[model samples]
Target: MSARPEQREDRRKDPVDAIVDQWAAVRPDLDTRAMEVFGRIFRLSRSMGDRMEKAYAPFGISRGEFDVLATLRRSGEPYTLSPRQLSATLMLTTGGMTGRLDKLERAGLLRRSPDPHDRRGLQVTLTEKGLDLIDRAVGAGLAVQSAGLSALDDEQVGRLADLLRELLAGTPGADH
Candidate 1:
């Protein structure tokens, strides 16, 4: 059975609705169409994350592990990156990142070695098996992403991407 529709009259029922109400009262003359677009984008981001987590589950890896592996894979340098570097690139707390590294090490997907340039530093490198595993996991993840976008036609997808890029480029302090 289809899910029951929410009551349409309840204008302030959801968080977005409440925000709209507040903005309508506070700044009635300002343009709010951008806010609507961004609000849906924010919600879509959360939904996308959940779908990505589900996609990674079959690889027996958490989202954190997948991110680390992907970073090393993309680094194009023997799959090695210092823990501090990884933390900075991944925007994770150093302590939390250390724990992820430890977990990956325990899983035999990565290893730590003394950094040649620094006496007190270690570089985390992926093993051969780890590379193979991540390769498969990445393929699966791409399939999931493709499935998620199946509803959009080729032209729609391209247009959406271009529009999103334009909007993203204009955001203050946006990540390049």
Candidate 2:
């Protein structure tokens, strides 16, 4: 059953505030209030990630694979990226990127070819089969993300997005 507005607000407050209360109880001088926001953000991230993983499951790819495919698909026509470019964009180790590329190539979703710009390096591109799979996977992934934030009204969601964008932009290690 759906909660009444007051009840829903109370439910949200109780658990999260209880955490801060516990910290204040044991260590009164310490300020742990930021935990409320950071904790919620962490929970939201995990929940959305879990949902998106389920969304990608039918396409037979993990979240990391989906990330690579989506990055290539978004890179515009030719849908190609060098292994270095992909690894940098994804912040993956060379071995990690190589592993994902190997799995996708084996799955017949993508292929690696000699980089035209740098003959010594290889580039990755989505096959026609990869294109179709990623198109569907992206659509499904968006649906999952949309549903995850459906609790918020449009204005709240927009405001939250803006706030998050600002925070992410200022944070260390976020894409500059």
Candidate 3:
């Protein structure tokens, strides 16, 4: 399903409309057909993120915050990791991870301390409060994600995941 025509009509008149129009004119000979599927995926990703954010609202945490806490929770016993470890594991830069840690700390969900093994490093640990919050938030997030995927049966979802994985693996920088 898509947004109503009333919503789409407004976008069609927007500035970026010219890009698609030009593409259609210049590439009439080539297939250029994959654009339809990939373009919708890009657009739907944005809309789906908005929906997921709204679903996280009741927990009073942004999705990014939840991601950090969840990562720490899943790291096994002691439920702690160094800032460097978290940043690398989450594919975030050091500065970006620091900002996330600051917000979570202010929310009383996590705490930071000097790493015992490395003077230059810091360990980020989920506070008891942070652990509880993530536990609940994760449950809610799963429900929302499951509902979103309900349009496809379990078997279909499995096949789709496999195909996507194969495609991703064949792409350059996938291993990087």
* Best prediction by lDDT: 2
Question: What is the C-alpha lDDT profile of model 3 across 74-161, one tens digit per residue?
Answer: 9976989998888887788999988999988999999999999889988899999988888998888888888878888999999988
Clashing pairs in 3: none
Candidate 3: segments with Cα more than 4 A from true spot = 1-26, 174-176
Per-residue lDDT tens digits for candidate 2, residues 152-175, read: 999999999999999888889875
Would you list the C-alpha lDDT of every candidate in the order shown? 0.84, 0.87, 0.79
The C-alpha stretches of model 2 lying farther than 4 A from their native spots are 1-11
Cand. 2 TM to true fold = 0.90
lDDT of 3: 0.79
| Global local distance difference test of model 1 | 0.84
- Residue 143 in candidate 1, Cα distance off native in Å: 1.1
Worst 10 residues of 1 by lDDT: 1-10
**Candidate 1 lDDT over residue span 13-61, tens digit each:** 6566567657767877655656666787798788888988998998889
TM-score of each: 0.80, 0.90, 0.80
Instruction: Supply candidate 3's per-residue lDDT for 33.
Output: 39
Off by over 4 Å in 1: 1-30
